[model samples]
Target: MSSLDKRGLKERLTAGENVLVAEGYLFEFERRGYLKAGAFVPEVVLKHPDLVRSLHEEFVHAGSDVVLAFTYYGHREKMRLIGKEDLLEPLNVGALRIAREVADKTGTLMAGNICNTTIFQRGDKEAVAKTRAMFKEQIEWAVQEGADFIVAETFSELGEAKVALEAIKEYGKGLPAVVTLAPQATDKTYDGVPMGEACRQLEEGGADVVGLNCHRGPKTILPLMTEVRRACKGPIACLPVPYRTFEECATMQSLKDPITGRREFPVDLPAHLCSRTEIGEFARACRAMGVQYAGLCCGNSSHFMRVLAEGYGRSPPSSKYSPDMSQHYVFGSDPSFKKYYQEGLIETVSLNNKV
Candidate 1:
């Protein structure tokens, strides 16, 4: 195995280097038919270990600097929701081990994952305690498996975000904590805390990196993230869903079908995915704004990741196969190409030319 972490994630970020993290395991695995969409628990880590490892490899090849564990929704509450509370410990351990193996082999940072419990309600001390316990076990397993950092992501409630940060500080064994929140359609956390103030609080609470992830797409999230960048004194992480969220529908959940006017989220959002070029543009924008850490959240794929890498001025392993339209048979301008082929290509391929 290759040596891991020549320079740690925090070290690189502190040195002004951008670290690309590939998340979106919940949606990616569901699309692959291994994970259930509604529940979204990462049983694939235990049931389909090879697939999980393969995805980690794909992200690494596509230029991801961090191999985030596929434990996004593998918390105690989520597992218990699906009546597999028995699988909680095994699932978390299995996911961490898979991520560690890949990170070690490829010399990338391995990040343990935790997300919102969905059970935490503000001012409810009982719910807060339950949330803490859930985070404690996951952090314990992550630290035990040698994770380089802990990524607490997709929490829409700022209250819960602090709890996750607190848990990380207590149980993370001094590893870096990357806490990213998911603001709702209002452009604020579910608890009504503005995005900037929320991120500011996280940084003040000792988070290594603070920003937003999930829910909103690139266009919608960037404006709020700008506020975070200005508010926080530390590195900021921005990983938006690869979708084209607009003014009317500022988040994937708020997206509506053009014809049917029905909701198209979770399972029916393929038509709304952002093109590779769009992702590249988003990456370039982030870099220009001095954002230190970047990546895509849900709806992320390897090709999309390659675009992000290239946008950030990186050429990952997959870049070797990036598009070379100049070499296309129908559009080639190379000297060796037949002039007749290029001249008639539009006429030959155009549907409008058909009799």
Candidate 2:
């Protein structure tokens, strides 16, 4: 089986064939030392080939029409963070190869995952420019390596999203591109740019689809989607993070609460985790709100995605209690490094050569 051509992707999106399901932890590589940064070890691809393959098959079995490859942090900068810059291309190519292999086996469409840049700050023109170049180079490589389309996920800043879109336009060679933003609790970016503005900017910058991802949770993103639909005409996608439970928040606060009486203060839990039921509901809402695509983000696993697929045409699930820890990990330390170096494994996995 071959990858979907541009015409095929355009037809799929236009025909309302959206609703992608993410297979979480597929791209998570083991790290070395306890605190030392680790590399994007090849073992993730080797040891988890069946895991990746099964995930693609499962999402397809669950009725999801699209599957995203495991290439979230596959870029050079992100790889450098884990001391695996040399493995960037191999990691990215392996991800696409695995996705394609699974798609060929299951007949599901695949979207190459080209996530946001490592940097989140805005106003750094030089850095942004360099990032755009990197994005362009990466997208070109993905296309050459055989990606059906591209999805740029977890973008918190519109400028970064714009730069990514610009890169796609320059190197996408007309491949379909979907852009997803990570809005703040106020339904805006960290820089205060409204979600609607960000959507519009991405659409203007040549994205086929513009939407939200990795935000607070389904409930918070629901309201934000309304604002985005109002301002943008392109297709939209919503991939919310899992909501936090009350006890989880309390436990966290107990651990981090420095002030003696701070724990006594009312902690209004921010809506975070969207259960399978809620995810399904959100997916339906997205379809109603003119969003052509919907999926899950951080802390969301294949099981959540399965439920999302099952709830494709239903009302959104009720909002559960969640915490407001969205900003806590904005610059948090990397945790996957410990497993990588501990194993001393670095064997590359080859594609099945069916593509």
Candidate 3:
């Protein structure tokens, strides 16, 4: 709409361009106090639409190539959990409209998003039907709202992910779909499918891009991406939460506070957040592995997104604020600084370094 290139998600990927999509909306909105964290229903779309739009604008300016609708957990189940079922349609439509506005204004792709319904049951036929219905309605709204593509993400089970992809293909009516799974502590879907096989299956089922997202952080997720890249033939997406997860705490949900020895997920995870350098490292690894779709999940910020963009060989508008430590009073080497006032600074720093 802003006279930017009209290429869709699939076309850009096909043209060998890496796409950066900024997600982590649930956590970001909660941190900003616009949405409640426990239920994470995303009613902010209906209550404070301007905030959602501003967040989308921020992500675009920080180098996101897509303005993904913040419809995560805006489904009937989540609404019912908070007794806001009446706001379901309005919330979904509102989120889509807000994202559409940002995408049009920023000339970024607008993506309609549907995530795994937590109510999905492996063997319960009724539950499975309900899950499909949830996906169907959201996809319909996304299509009707003129979404450029669909993103069905964070499915913890491979079966549920396939259902989402199927619904996207059926209800999306030709819009490309990006399906990403969130593996649990065992490095596999809750249903026991390995991450790589799961992504491969999604690719076979017609997902334009298939890979992992959320739940895990860079250290834990990057190793899994290796298998995903090897198994999938088409584009792969890697969007991990910006936390410091490792073998001990394989996923953020399992992270423990070093001092308290209690799980610190959802809340109190700031203590373990990954540095911008780590996120940049993740982006470099993603580019090296040929991950066509790269991004951060929960705990992402505009600054982190900028670092990721730089690591991907992109200079987003927000990069203008990237840190320049060379100007630090104690560490600066700029010739214009008066040497008399800072002559003893380097000696003092060296003395302090002595352990």
Candidate 4:
């Protein structure tokens, strides 16, 4: 609609080329915490245009190839929760316009952002259908306004993700679509579906690339990629958040505890922090495992992605060591054979090293 080639973007994405995408808050809510009610008031965006612009520039400078518009909660229903449903199109268009301007100047791609519903309630077919329609309307608008791609990110269940894929096919038609899932504690969807199953569902439902983003940190999701790889045939993109462990949260609570017989006051700690180098390591591992696209999510910035791109071009991990050597070394001894083997051993040191 805006002279952008939707089919071309789909081709590129399906081919497994690298694409950098960025996402952050446009409103002034609790910084780096999970989304809650009253978190996306319109006034926050009006007051923080400069902050949004600065972040866009930061990501572009850090070698990002794409910048996603800050319209994760820009749907009509989510806005109605805050009594601003009328501002849906305006807010969504404004964020895209701003991101497009920055991306145009930096020669980066711009993707339209679509997040999960406000409440993650599963098994509601009607609600899921409604969300799908709203998402289709929003994505069509974004494409008309010139978005290079559409990212349905942080989805919590396979059913919801399936609806999103259907919407993309119906409205987006030919635009590239990337669907990212957020897993619960056991690395399964909130609805108890495995990550591999989710990936398969997304791919079968018409997603160009199936991946994971938000929810957990890099360290936790890195090990799960093997399963994801086995499940889907398409390219994988991993955008992990830098999260604080439960231990760290408990430690902070203890430090803020009061000594007297009074109520426990809430502690206001800074957002969880992560180093670019650590994120780079995660990206490198993904690349080594044949991941074609890589980026950062919550608690991560553009610098994190730049390190990732740099790390992707470096050498891969070595596989010279035998996989069973550790197990052999740990359970190699047989007490019954000690007397029998001692007489046959030419050198006792060689037997010790072998065991």
lDDT score, residue 79, model 4? 83
Candidate order, TM-score descending: 1, 3, 4, 2
Query: Model 3, residue 182: displacement in angstroms?
Result: 0.1
Off by over 4 Å in 1: 1-5, 335-338, 348-355
Off by over 4 Å in 3: 1-3, 336-355
Among these predicted structures, which one has the highest lDDT? 3
Pairs of residues clashing in candidate 3: none
Q: Write the per-residue lDDT of candidate 3 for residues 210-319, one digit (tens) a residue.
A: 99999999999999999999999999999999999999888999999888899898889888999988999999999999999999999998999999999999988888
- RMSD to true structure for each model, in Å: 1.8, 15.6, 1.8, 13.1
The whole-model C-alpha lDDT of candidate 1 against the native structure comes to 0.91
For all candidates, the clash counts are 0, 13, 0, 0
**How many Å off is the CA of 266 in candidate 4?**
12
In model 2, state the lDDT of residue 297: 63
Name the regions of candidate 4 deviating beyond 4 angstroms.
1-8, 11-16, 26-44, 119-122, 244-272, 314-355
Instruction: Report the error of model 1 at residue 41, Å.
Output: 0.9
lDDT measured at residue 250 in model 2 versus the true structure, 0 to 100: 20
lDDT of 1 by residue, 91-148 (tens): 9999899999989899999999999898998999999999999999999999999999
The residue pairs in collision within model 4 are none
Candidate 4 overall lDDT versus native? 0.66
Rank all candidate structures by their lDDT, best first, as comma-separated numbers.
Answer: 3, 1, 4, 2
